[model samples]
Target: MAFRPLGRRAYGSIPHLPGSRTGPADRHLSPALARTLTQRARDARDHVVVLEKLDGSCVAAARVGDSLLALGREGQLAAHSANEARRLWATWVARHAERFLAVLRPGERVVGEWLALAHGTRYALPHEPFVAFDLMRDEARSPWREVTERLGNAGFVLPGLVHEGAPLAVEAVMERLGGAGFHGALDPVEGAVWRLERRDAQGVRVELLAKYVRPDKVDGSLLPENSGRPAHWNWRPEAPPPPPEMS
Candidate 1:
């Protein structure tokens, strides 16, 4: 499919930054969040959710005044004038800036994971731009439902959301992963991250409670086997995982 950016603009009016703000250079990076899980692999009582893990690299879009910044997963400034990935990211931002700006107020920022065509089967995916998962925000409310609804109306594909019960266990998470056949799947994704939504002094926040992955389920043939790469590398899951004993 030909990739089209969303119709939203960046920030229309610059709003005051929340709390004591610092320059972008001094801003602290968001930490990796995980989810909590319970024990019992086959038990449906465990709280867990599943979504298709898109095969692509990470991209983040932030608006400061009239300027819009696109950053790669490594926190480097994305330069479309030089790299293919940055060029694609720039196209995506241009197309979706309007809607993105609408969802995010001025001064406030929304951090999401961008999945594009770079490696594996997704490389052939036309256009190569879309938001896979929402990570964090500085807004007053959880804009997930609103942002997703807007994206849907604008004909943009937002990442899927599944709401499982509360108090999830490890066995239950593994059961869902096994049933999902995560490893056998053709997509080159690691697994899902667990999250919890709550309200605090900072408004509504979705916390990255944990990350989960079943190594046995991954398709080893697709990856560089015996290439002396870091064997302990784990896929960043959208939802966090339960403890090891739970699995």
Candidate 2:
């Protein structure tokens, strides 16, 4: 499928700077183009899937020459800073470069999320790990399913998918968030993205995508509701509710 340029403002009004390759695999930092939430009702007869939204930042992994480059979502050279988390990620890629390359073709790029706490943030974890949720290739189509399989084979933990026909409502999403066995918190997120399988004008396979942020997180605050004020950032995991007793 041909790649259709995102709506002029769909990715924000930031003019494309020269020498910058804004391919789908590249991550940008346009707050104006934050992910939006979806209002589509779940179909009772169609399959629906739910995934745990990790509260980490974004990262991109690509095969650069004989090595791999791991970049932050904002297109920063992550290892330049004295951040220990960044160093750890760099080391991880170096150690696992061979495994990643087995699935990645030359010049291909893979997008993943990097979850870590910044300096002075109380939400810091003991270690830094990553989870890949998207992938892109240079010569071939974006094989998302293949990417997931490759990552799984490499022993990486990918997000889970729920398949059901029931419509996914905010309440349902919240319930999934509060369920047990997940590692992340249930704080308001930028929102979820819906991927639609379709072809573009060039007859190339592409995904019609949309993003939705929670009403509260829209303003860049972590508040549960948009209260028109800055709220404290909480990363502590909430205890799951107890199971109901037999009637």
**Which candidate achieves the best TM-score against the true structure?**
2
Alpha-carbon local distance difference test for all models: 0.43, 0.44
- lDDT of candidate 1? 0.43
**For residue 168, what is the lDDT in candidate 2?**
47
lDDT digits (tens) for residues 1-247 of candidate 1: 3221222332121111112123344332233222233322223323334343443556667666766666565445554334444555656676678866655444544544444432332222332246545523433324345555655565555544433445454444445544323222334344444445544565545432344343443323333343344322223224322222322
Off by over 4 Å in 2: 1-50, 82-84, 118-128, 138-143, 163-171, 179-181, 186-191, 199-204, 218-247
Q: What TM-score does structure 2 among the candidates reach?
A: 0.55
Clashes of each: 37, 15
lDDT of 2 by residue, 1-247 (tens): 3222221111111221112224444343333222211234322222233444444556666775666776555444455434445545555666677877876766666666555432111232332356666666542435345656777777666654532233345444545544321444334333343343333445434333333334343232333244444433332223312332444
Worst 10-residue lDDT window for candidate 2 reads 4-13
